[model samples]
Target: MGFIEEFKHAYAGDETHHYHVARKQVTCLHCGGEDFDRGSALLNTTGLTFLRLDWVNREAHLLICAGCGEIRLFLEKPDRV
Candidate 1:
């Protein structure tokens, strides 16, 4: 399987994984107008061991606003329980 598939599988098996997404308005802090476009990095992390099969770390997506050129970033991971 590809890297992405592997990551997903690991996340599914790890209950301690901290996976979450943060949503922010892509409007200027001064002016509330939705207008933005941005790029974000993808990241994934996995444990190193015989249980390496149970670890994962990777990027998901980018946040953008098509109104006022505002851009937001996102970095999500499974929440640790």
Candidate 2:
């Protein structure tokens, strides 16, 4: 499934018991819009910097606004095993 669909599934299913995703009050800062496109924050060069620093433990989540293309970042804590 797509990132957004996966997010919706996790939010509505038992997957949320083990994982945390910030879907609350997420809006576009630039356009003040409520619609967004979910994606991986590590899909870009910026997230690659963390890999180079051995900081790959954490995962960065991204929400791209459908209106003005504003991106919001949310960092996930490292998983244990």
Candidate 3:
């Protein structure tokens, strides 16, 4: 699917407002700022092990504090695969 479809698939039918509520609880570690610029990282890996399917690529969520430019990268919690 496309980007929008992928997002919908990930969140199911839940609204993103819940994320806003959770966001309110976040604080920058460096400067203790509440405001942040959020984004996602699309990553791809193609090393020897990855080529042999020993490793898989995944996306990361980024939270950058506006005040101090400190960044936090969030990866999904691992589950049984």
Candidate 4:
């Protein structure tokens, strides 16, 4: 299971959820296209042991366009959660 898959699952179950992502972009920088494919938001909890938090949340998107084969990122707003 990947982040995108997990995100979709979460979305299906409930609308309020958390997602982690490195960066946020509306369109693909490479292709400059608006079309995007939805993906999962997976958390990478490698560090943060000191904070007593084992996991760091992340939201990721596939953001791909079939016409140009471009990939972008989709981000969630704080209010959305």
lDDT for 51 (candidate 3): 41
For each candidate in turn, the TM-score is: 0.28, 0.47, 0.47, 0.38
Residue-pair clash count for candidate 4? 8
**Pairs of residues clashing in candidate 3:** none
After superposition, candidate 1 runs with Cα above 4 Å error: 1-30, 34-56, 77-81
Regarding lDDT, does 3 or 4 come out ahead? 3
What overall lDDT goes with each candidate model? 0.36, 0.47, 0.46, 0.41
List model 3 lDDT by residue over 6-75, tens digit each.
Answer: 2112333322211232334566778877665665555444332344633544565655566786766555
Worst 10 residues of 1 by lDDT: 10-19
Candidate 4: residue 6 lDDT (0-100): 41
Which has the greatest lDDT?
2
Expressed as tens digits, the lDDT of each residue in 1-81 for candidate 2 is 222222221123222111224434666678887665555533344445534733543346655566787666666532211
TM value for model 2: 0.47
| Candidate 1: count of backbone clashes, pairs at least 3 residues apart or interchain | 24
lDDT of 1 by residue, 1-81 (tens): 232322222222212211224433334443454433334444434322333533433454343444443434444532222
Error of 4 at 51 (Å): 14
Q: Which tens-of-lDDT digit does each residue in 9-56 have in candidate 4? A: 323322222222444335456766644444455544432344344443
| Candidate 4: C-alpha lDDT | 0.41
Deviation of model 1 at 62, angstroms: 1.6
